[model samples]
Target chain A: MNPLRPIGAAFLRFLEATGRLSEFTAVAVSHCVRPPFYFRLLLRQMIEIGYYSLPVVGLTTLFTGMVLALQSYTGFSRFSAQGALPYVVVLSMTRELAPVLAGLMVAGRIGAAMAAEIGTMRVTEQIDALATLSTNPHKYLIAPRLIAGLTMLPLLVLVGDVIGVFGGYVISIYKLGFNPGIYLKSTWQHLEFMDVFSGVVKAAVFGFIVALMGCYNGYHSRGGAQGVGAATTNAVVSASIMILISNYIITELFFAK
Target chain B: MSAPSNPVPKIRIRNLCKRFGSNVVLDGVDLDIATGESVVVIGGSGSGKSVLLKCILGLLEPDDGIIEVDGLSAIGLGAGEREAVNRKFGMLFQSAALFDSLKVWENVAFGLIQGGRMDRIQAREIAFAKLADVGLKAEVGELWPAELSGGMKKRVGLARAIATTPEIVFFDEPTTGLDPIMSDVINDLIAKCVRELGATALSITHDMASARKISDRIAMLYKGRIVWNGPTAEIDRSGNDYVDQFIHGRAEGPIRMEVRAP
Candidate 1:
């Protein structure tokens, strides 16, 4: 009946879960680097994670860029600092918004799919079948996903950066009655290479997190239909949370004095 | 009970014990299968039959037991040894557990291409041949698992299991969900497949008809222990109350179903 008992039990459960996840992550990473690589599976995953996600990432970033320009102009006009609008829009899109937004979108899309597919496999004994077939589930199912996610997200974010900046340019020139050439010049002038570089690095880490969480949740799912449903929800939710948390840590590493 | 006298059984289990918390699912179970011999373990739901099979298959580790395949201990085997042991096995799941992402032919050819490192072309040919052995056409192999019917899925599962020509094959409730006729057909296919390959067969099922049809020897598991073991021909006269009750499908017997109010 002790009140402290519940807290101790909860802490123990947390420790147990953390230990399981750490072990799974170690095994997944080891399989990623090992040989007898599945080139065909990796290619398919790259197309799934990267090529198919173009429209979502593109549309999300494009609108985000346009809104940032308008919001910044309104805030800066009172101080007669409206000229800083281009710098603000370009930096925000590259440094934070595009990567984080695109990451959240892809996590909802790819991460949920990975969980549902792998979760179904686990419940149906297909994962155990892989082991019987002399194929490691980590190698056949997870490593390809991790590899594709790590490699493809940066590229998606880079493309997003361009489209997002262009959205801001469109708003500034036509809607806000600013000179197109000057806006572009201003955006380019104040931008540092580190801004884009840090975002790309964050995108890569987010991609890995999304894939890892999806695979981890799905691989461990038990029971049946309900278990898979829970796994899918966990995959998307956990991936999104991890993306936001990691984004800040990477930002601090790059931007903090 | 002691295992039957065999010079070197293909698979041997002694003092096998497994439990989930306070619920003991296997208690000091012992059994043996000789080379090219077919054995079926019969038990009702919750009788630990599947757990016994899984322990032998290395899917679940028994808390205490000795499992030997070809005189090599299967428990606690290193990765290389485990993979080698598993390479000799093919299992037909109760659900036919095909990879929905792959076409039927790819599922059949998976072990050959992935495990044997054979080229796809060669593997596909062998896959088609295995499918033919299970009375399936080449065209059927092109379809995905979801497109197939329940019976077709079982046939494809059998084809996949035998495609690699494994030395040992395990069937986990192979005909559980099929119609009576379909079950007989699957049982026939199983017997034919096992005979053609001269493989050691171990099947677990609640269906007495299936056990009688596919097994040379039958073992009855009750409450996590073997209550009876005898040749298939002698099962009808097993003389044990549990065996008689199960084979007859009687509601009133020594075995009672646990149906407690939630």
Candidate 2:
């Protein structure tokens, strides 16, 4: 009857569940190497997870870029450093803001949806149906989503970089009375391919983590409706946390020098 | 072990035991299903009937057992080997479990196109034909799973299960959530499909009417073990108290429900 007993039990259960997940992942990797690869399903998931996610990422990046430009200009102008506006804007957008914002946006959108969809399938026994029909659900479901995440995230990051830079350009030239040519020149001169590449690479890794967490939580979900909801919540929260953690690690790796 | 000489049994399980934690679901269970035979396993809710089927299908691993299909050991098969074993199976899920994102025909044609690597046009043609076989119109094939009625969804599920004309077919609780008339219709369709395909079938259901209608042999699962098994015609005279208590839906019996104080 102790109150701490339930909390202790829950903690133990969580550890046990994590252990199971590690085992499932090992099995999934092994299955992936064996053939009868479902290329069509992978292509279909790529379209759903990647192509469909472009618009949302693009919109978020554009608005974010514009706002960052405005905010940086406001902050820098107070110190009479308005000349450094373009350098700061492009550097910030490409190196940190674009990938992080894009990762978070996708975590909310694609991560939640993937979890819910896979969770519903688990409850409905569609995943079981796949197994009974000689189809490996991991191969058919997880592999495609993973491939899509790895492939599409880089593209989404590229799009985000462009939109974010363009947003800064608009705010600088129209709102802040800067010369468009000079602004563009300063932005290009300050930004390096390595910065863009690193951000894109982070986006890809973040995307993979998001989809993996979503699919993993949902695929192993039990009970029913409430379980599906829990899976979705866990997927979004976990993916967001992983994104933040990985972002820091990648930053150190890329900019340590 | 000596392999059967002439016709191979489609599925065979020996000394199967499954325990979830300390709670046992299947205990020393053994079953054999011959080619072209229809076997129905019947039991009360929580009777481990589904667990037995899942073990045979290799979806759940048994704690200690051997499961063979077409003389191939299914228990420890690798992924490629498991896929080969699974290619011989078609299953109708209890909830239909249709993919909402796909059109009806696409769902039906999923295995044929995706697993079998058949062309889309050919798969669609086969899917439409299978739909027609289940008395569903061609137009139903174009609609999504969400758009279909419960009965229609079950029919579409039936079509998808049989899309590849698998050698063995499993029906899990085929009549659980349907009107009596609709259940009868599904049973009839099941019977017809089994006959036409000459496929071995293993179905689990609590519906005695369905068991009687579709099965040549009936097995009754009780307390993690099959207590009674024989030809379907002998079910009425089995004279087993557990079977009687179950078939009549009586509250007073050896089988007791676990009631806990809240």
Candidate 3:
């Protein structure tokens, strides 16, 4: 009986924390519409959270596409179905790998950074300062981030999709001895607009989740340095989990027969 | 001071209560701040001083209370109303919380340009003027917050707080982490600014020197309630043991440290 007590306490804590998060999100959304937009601050956040994250997302997608081609080639060649390599690579990149990998990467990079920056601000009473100055922190801080996340994620995914397809193209033509034209044609034929659209949409949602979790944890962080570090970790973990869960739900919506 | 006969307190709290789960931070706290008076709330760390300030600012909702500013109830106000109320106040944070992304002048002019909807040129002019009021040069307005020293940043924060020329100002731990000389400088600047603007000021600090220097009235917060409140000159004769021990920074007093066996 005593052994289960700690588990029950943890569950209750989880419920409390979840309720707090919901309240925070509600406040953030309300603040989004108010006036006093800080366009300059928003542009800076976009550059940092979106543009600077391109290299890592790009590199990850490229390698992922290349590996998919190599593995699919090996498996299909056993059945004399090596010709399906182009379709497999393009489908995987456009449908799942591109968005998921890009999301995970940005979740680690931008999510942690947002949490640290905001958490530090919280500990130092900067958020309070904003309120006292009559500036809504949600409008000034979270809205710009939410807008940037929504806009930048799709852009990042589009870039990743392009790089991923190029990765497959290079591997197939040079290493696998496939006709470049035929491989390209097969990829174009097999991929649908829905697939690309769904992936990009998922990127937007993932970006929102990442930014939301980072901001929520940061704004509510307590204590000091330890609290900030904990918030950063929580942002990454929560963003990653939400991305995976949302990906499944979106897939179910789009692909359920 | 002659009574203005307009019975509205500058800031009023009646039966204000705040609780974080089972921990009560403010318990049935009632206070009145008159117009153009500088009141300092002195308390030990973790004594709910910040919580009281936050409640007044509407940053934290009091579980049970009525907080009124200039005769308007701030609690449960709609977004527009709350914003209108906030526009009448300014704040200087403990660490001079300037926005790192903005130039110094932009930070000061943030409320003017955004909330007041003034044009950029006009806002910048007023910002430069306010910066000058805080003893900062016009060129210093071009620098980022990260590029400024602690004292300089505090001055910029002061400039930002007064940029809109609000009727009330709140200073949270104004001298918590400053050198004595810098602390004195900030104290003097605060006195000068409040006098010049004729603004009502509410400040929270553990620094006795700061309290003595800048306060017209001093209120001691202990255990989520004000134990002693009177004119600054009466602090020495507060005749309360808690006040006596806290003012002298004595360890062996009625205030017990929550130190557990290690």
- Reference-based lDDT, each prediction: 0.93, 0.87, 0.89
Model 3: per-residue Cα lDDT over B41-95, one tens digit each: 9999988999999888888888998899988799987666777888989989888
The full ranking of all candidates by DockQ, starting with the best, is: 1, 2, 3
Off by over 4 Å in 2: A1-40, B1-8, B259-262
DockQ score for candidate 3: 0.59
TM-score for each candidate, following the candidate numbering: 0.98, 0.92, 0.92
B217: Cα error in model 3, Å: 1.9
Cα lDDT of model 3 by residue, A216-239, tens digit? 888888889999999999999999
Top model number, TM-score: 1
* Best DockQ among the predictions, by candidate number: 1
State each candidate's clash count.
0, 0, 0
Clashing pairs in 2: none
The CAPRI category of model 3 is medium
Candidate 3: residue A21 Cα off by (Å)? 2.9
Interface C-alpha root-mean-square deviation, candidates in order: 0.9, 1.2, 1.4
Docking category for candidate 1? medium
- Candidate 3's C-alpha runs over 4 A off are A1-4, A30-38, B1-6, B238-262
Q: Which of candidates 2 and 3 reaches a greater lDDT? A: 3
lDDT of 2 by residue, B1-262 (tens): 1122346677888888999999999988888888778999999888898888788777888899889898888897776788788889898988898988789999999889777889999999999999999999999999989999888898999899888999888999998899999999999999998888878889999999999999999888988888888888888889888888887888899878777769
TM-score of candidate 2 relative to the true fold = 0.92
